[model samples]
Target: MSTPHVVVVMGVAGTGKTTIGPLLAARLGVPYAEGDDFHPPANIAKMSAGTPLDDSDRWPWLDAIGGWAHGRAGLGGVVSSSALKRSYRDRLRAAAPDVVFVHLSGDRALIEDRMAHRQGHFMPTALLDSQFATLQPLEADEAGVAVGVDGTPEEIAERAVEALAALPEPAL
Candidate 1:
């Protein structure tokens, strides 16, 4: 694609979206945005307390991230979001029509281990099951690819880049 593609690093909690997002953005020479930074304090508090966010708590937050993706459309950027539901991805696509998702997927055991070792994140290991349950993998018609999180952050980002390269260009 001649225009820059908005690449959203999406997955369940603890899948390393934040870790790999900036790397992928750097590799593609685009701006980077952190999805967590866009969350409202209430959402953070809820997640920190081990409560899974309901759709009511998420719509506004998702809109904010979608707005960011909209702002970066055509110019490219990487943003990390849990994007655990198909409807959530659809919301983002509405804002940024050309957005492409890179889903970092992994087994529950591996994800839980990663969450346990994580520090200072609002999302706790207790909420991982909810995140997984909420997640809907990219559908065949979606403009995205699912990359396994079986490697180091760098390796995963590299794999994402390769996957993106292999895909047919998103419609302009």
Candidate 2:
């Protein structure tokens, strides 16, 4: 459990990865990248049209993101993504063993609320349920912590920082 140099705030859509990632990055004093920005045009279009992406649609994008992760977090960087499946996390881990996932767990109501209230996002509110259905909560076997979203964004970010701080430092 080395302190994660490259940390990913991961979960299904509306789990606050975008909102909390930057805060976590600030806490860790590392630069951050939003996983959505890495999505290829087709994936973005599908999601914008309220279609949930399948594995085939995701693999290439995931690979590209992994390559980016390899370079930035090879040294260490913070990233935010809806890393909903074990395979997705594996792609990231393949890039860097030091990569750690921060799983944000919240109930459907709260997540839907966030998605509905979210503004200026390509992902549509209609896709929320599908995202939840597709989400495979990170297993304990995965190397990281599962954080409960039971408080303010500040509280969650601070809790994540504290947990990360307690882990052993990266081997780098």
Candidate 3:
């Protein structure tokens, strides 16, 4: 079988990273990972208590996820990460140089509505503003695509797959 693309489905809280990640992985015939699962308990607690995590708290978590991405680099998989800042993405890229990102973007109102309706998530709605403030959209040189979250998860995943396919293959 051909190696699958290792994709990081990224965005702020409630942009549907968790929801869309599995769909994208399944559509691409790859394994799926939830980035939140890599978080340290302390970090989860902080977010659950409606506090935004500091850089120190996030670095280890990002490194863990990046390490996971490194493990799956050639094997292919889909994982979700907030990846709210350029520096965070760079850290992940450092671990998995070939990884691609799929940024889920949408209007603030829509994201807030989703977060409000979300259940069983550690991230609280009160931290949504902080998340947006920290989010830095993918730059032009980045190996990724920004898919708007205006459609069903399936539609969004479809668009992601198409976008990934359209990208030129990495030079050896």
Candidate 4:
């Protein structure tokens, strides 16, 4: 039997991480975790106030998510995280060595429009630029797929699943 991978649905704000992660998890028959739920109140407050978080503010949040990923390791699961920087992804990989990422990619204009229309979310449209500036696309060596976000959430999740299937399985 093939090993089940813990999938991290990643992208900038409004790239549909929250929306797609659960669908992807459902498709994969794994539990889904909201990355924002891992953040401390302070981090949420900072972002809610239109302030972008620095590395220091992110470590704990990343650690919390990492811990959850670590626990879900072999059993398989899905989680949503912005994971904008290479270092942040590295931290997650360290915790769950076999985890794979599904990066929801899209142009700035579309993402900004989505953010503007979304309600009750902590991240503001004002922070969208910062998110783009911080995003570092997955490198060649990373065990991940960059799926475009130009379709409905179900379509995007389907693309992600198809892309993930194309990846070479990790060596034991």
Candidate 5:
């Protein structure tokens, strides 16, 4: 049997990457990894202090997540990442070339409102602007789909699955 594709549930913070990732993984019958868990303590500390991470602060974190994705390459998995920049996504793709993304797209107002209501997340609502500024939506050459984050987690997951299923199978 052929191996399944690993899906990267990506978006800016407060887009429900954490909520939808597990559901998407369940739908795909794959394990789920929380990208934030891979961050170094320093990175977490910086964010918790309301400081935005620069590229230097993110490289190691991205590499850690990439390593996990690399390990699950053939096994299939769902991982969450606020893969805001194209360069960040490129780093992930370098580790697992076949990994596809499910970008959770939504309006700034909606995301900020959700962020404000969330509790205990290290990423502050203040960083939402930076995230939006950094985001580079998937390009035509990228193998992924964008799903609206305007509904319940279950509904969004279903839409993600449908969109992913509709993608043309990647060339081996």
Candidate 6:
């Protein structure tokens, strides 16, 4: 079992994908893709206005992330996305079978705190519940780490990377 190069940093809003994704990618010597980049203009506007997006607004963004992750994984890159629903993850897997989804778990209060502290982000704190409402924790069948983010950013990232290290590499 070889280690998968494709990884998604996931969780509800404010779980720190934006914070840790780049560091992880740098450690792995791969470029990191921000999931927000794939969002349609309308979707961005909706979120920017503190509106929660329904599945209809999400499918296209998820598909784009799927495509980007698959393409990058084939070339040994990593992506960070908040693929909230199981169906979304499934859609992503359809494109990037080799992906490992790293789940960043934390309490609503903590996430809310982080979101409140964050500045100049399009995602409003008001949308936190919608994010939590949509979030589906990673399952046993998924290949990845699920770290509880009730600690420092370094600790959380370290735990995730440590977990990733423990996964046996698939035979090349």
Top lDDT model: 4
Deviation (Å) of 64 in candidate 2: 1.8
**lDDT tens readout by residue for model 3, 107-170:** 9999999999988888888999999999999998888989999989899989988888887776
Question: Which model, 2 or 5, shows the larger lDDT?
Answer: 5
lDDT (CA) for every model shown? Answer: 0.90, 0.81, 0.90, 0.91, 0.91, 0.82
Rank list by TM-score: 4, 1, 5, 3, 6, 2
- Over 66-93, each residue of candidate 2 has an lDDT whose tens digit, in order, gives 8877887546778888888898888888
Top model number, TM-score: 4
What residue pairs clash in candidate 2, if any at all?
3-168
> Total clashing residue pairs per candidate?
0, 1, 0, 0, 0, 5
Model 4 C-alpha lDDT per residue in residues 1-172, reported as the tens digit of each score:
1567789999999999999999999988899999999999999999999999999999999999999999997898999999999999999989888879999999999988998999989999999889989999999999999999998999999999889888887621
Model 2 segments more than 4 A misplaced: 1-4, 168-172
Candidate 5 Cα deviation (angstroms), residue 38 = 0.3
- The residue pairs that clash in candidate 1, if any, are none
Candidate 6 clashes between residue pairs 3 or more apart in a chain or in different chains: 1-169, 1-170, 1-171, 2-169, 2-170
What is the per-residue lDDT of model 5 for residues 24-110, given as tens digits with 9 covering 90 to 100?
A: 999989999999999999999999998999999999988988999999978899999988888999999998898899999999999
Query: Residue 156 in model 5: shift from native, Å?
Result: 0.1
Model 1 earns a TM-score of 0.97
Instruction: Look at candidate 4 and tell me the lDDT of residue 146.
Output: 96
Clash count, candidate 5: 0
Candidate 6, which ten residues in sequence have the lowest lDDT sum?
Answer: 163-172
Task: Compare candidates 3 and 4 on lDDT and give the better one.
Answer: 4
Error at 159, model 2, angstroms:
1.0
